[model samples]
Target: MQEILVLYYSHRGSVRALAEMIAQGIDSVPGAAARLRTVPRISAVCEATEPDIPSTGAPYAETQDLEECIGLALGSPTRFGNMAAPMKYFLDNTAGPWLSGALAGKPACVFTSTASQHGGQESTLLSMMTPLLHHGMLLVGLPFSEPDLTRTRSGGSPYGATHWAGKDDNIQLTDEEKRLATALGKRLAETALKLHAR
Candidate 1:
């Protein structure tokens, strides 16, 4: 099976929900598999403060995951229109892959969740793309051709996928949000398969 990494840092389960939907889409492709991984929470006091393994949800991501996956789906919650610190901290430490071009030519997608409709979802998604661009990865994003992208009232975007979690972060994903996320993943997996064919 070809493994596509679904790497994310979800603060209040909203991003994690999106990641699961994306993984579902990836798993729908025959010969494609979703490899779910997550990074540890950052600590202010010291480095390597988080345990090597998390207590729940996906395991902590390793640089090796980036090297091994055929494609990548990156997701994180928005923090002041940027990716959360933990995710950024993890990306900042990817010098090994950056130097070796381990992710070069691989297909990638981005996703984000926000506390409100205007809570910097697009900016967060764009920010996540910066490093992948530097790594020479091929960005795969949703298109307006997806009906949901044109009509979704909640969290769907051409840049990738998004969710509006509301002020309390209690809102469940709307159907449109779910479908678009799945579409993004399916699109990404198909692209990875085509590239891997070469």
Candidate 2:
């Protein structure tokens, strides 16, 4: 099976929910598997560190994960119209992959969760794509062909899948958001398969 990396950092459960749904979609593809990974929270104190294994969630990602995966699904919580600091910090440390062109020509997609309806989901997705582009990865996005792209009043976009978790991060992903996120994953996996085949 070809593995697609579902790498993310979730401050709350919202982004993790979307990542899970996306993983389900990825696994639905015949020869695709989702390798779930997460990063530790960035500490405010320079001396602080997180355990190698997270207490309750996905294992911490290493650059080896990026090199081995056939494709990538990047997710993060929105932070002032940008990706959260932890996700950004992890991406910033990928110099080895960047130097070796490890992710070149790979398929990639992005997702994000935000605290409000206008919490900049699109911007966060775009910001996450910047480094992937530098790595020469091909980007995949939802198109109008997916009915959910038009029907999702909550968190679907042509840019990528998204979720509005409300001001307190209490909202669940709407059905439309779920379908769209799944569709985005399937699309990503299918695209990765075709590219890897070449």
Candidate 3:
């Protein structure tokens, strides 16, 4: 099976919800599977460290996961118009992959959740794409052709998928948001398959 790594850092579960939907879409494609992984929270204290295995949710992602996957779906909650620190921390350490060009030509998509409708979802998605671009990964985004993209009143974007989690972060994803997220995943998987076939 071809694996597409669904890598994310979710704090309030909003991003996690989106990640699950995306994984479902990836799995829907025959011969393509989702490898869900997450990174641990980073501590401000320089000496602090997280456990090797997380207490719940996905396992902490290793560099090997990047090497094994044919495609990538990166997600994170917005932090001041940018990706959360934990996800950024993980990507900051990907110099090894960058040097080896391990992710070159692999298809990638980004997703994000925000506390408000204007909580910088697009900026966060764009921020996350920077590292993937540096790795030479091809970006896949929601196109206007997706009906949900034109209809979504809550969370969806041409840049990628997004969720408006509300200030309390308790709002459920709208139907349109779910459909768009799933479509983005399927698109990434299909793109990866086509590229891999070459």
Candidate 4:
């Protein structure tokens, strides 16, 4: 089966919740599966290090995860209109994969959760796409065809799936947000499967 990497960084757990929904979407594809991974928190001190494995949630992501997956779904909480430091830090280390074209031609999608409606959900999603683009992965966004994109008042975007977690970071994923995230995962996996079949 083809694996779609569901990679994310979630400090408040909102983005991780979104990642799980996306993974469900990926797993729904008949011949595809989800490889869930998360990055370690970045210590402000340069020399500090995280344990080799996290205490809970998905394991820390490795460079091999990028090369092995047929598709990718990247997620993060909005960090001042950008991806969180840990996710960015992990992507920054993929130079070897970039040099080898290990991720070239793979289908990819992005997702994020922001603290408020006007928070940088779309920008964070767009920023997450940069590294995937650099790696030559095909970008996939939630199209207008997904009815939720037209009806969602909370957090669905054509750029990708997103959620508004509120100020306390307590808002749960709405049904629409969940549906769109799953759709993105399915779309990415289906696209990757077709591309690999060729």
For residue 145, model 1's alpha carbon misses the true position, in angstroms, by 0.8
Q: Clashing pairs in model 4?
A: none
Compared with the true structure, all predictions reach lDDT values of: 0.94, 0.93, 0.94, 0.91
User: lDDT per residue, candidate 1, 97-138, as tens digits?
Assistant: 999999999999999999989989999999999999999999
Error of 3 at 56 (Å): 1.2
Query: Candidate 4 on 1-198: residue-level lDDT in tens?
Result: 888899999898988988998999889999999999999999899899889999999998899998888889999998899999988988999999999999999899999999889988888989999889999999999899999998988899998999998887874899999999899988988898999899
TM-score for all predictions? 0.97, 0.97, 0.97, 0.97
Q: Any idea what lDDT model 4 has?
A: 0.91
lDDT at 193, model 3: 94
Candidate 4 at residue 74, lDDT? 93
The lDDT of model 1 is: 0.94
Tens-place lDDT per residue, model 3, 62-123, is 99999999999999999999999999999999999999999999999999999889989999
Off by over 4 Å in 2: none
The TM-score, computed over Cα atoms with residue i paired to residue i, of candidate 1 is: 0.97
Least accurate 10 contiguous residues by lDDT in model 2:
164-173
Lowest lDDT block of 10, candidate 4: 164-173
Please give the distance, in angstroms, between residue 40's alpha carbon in candidate 1 and its true position after superposition. Answer: 0.8
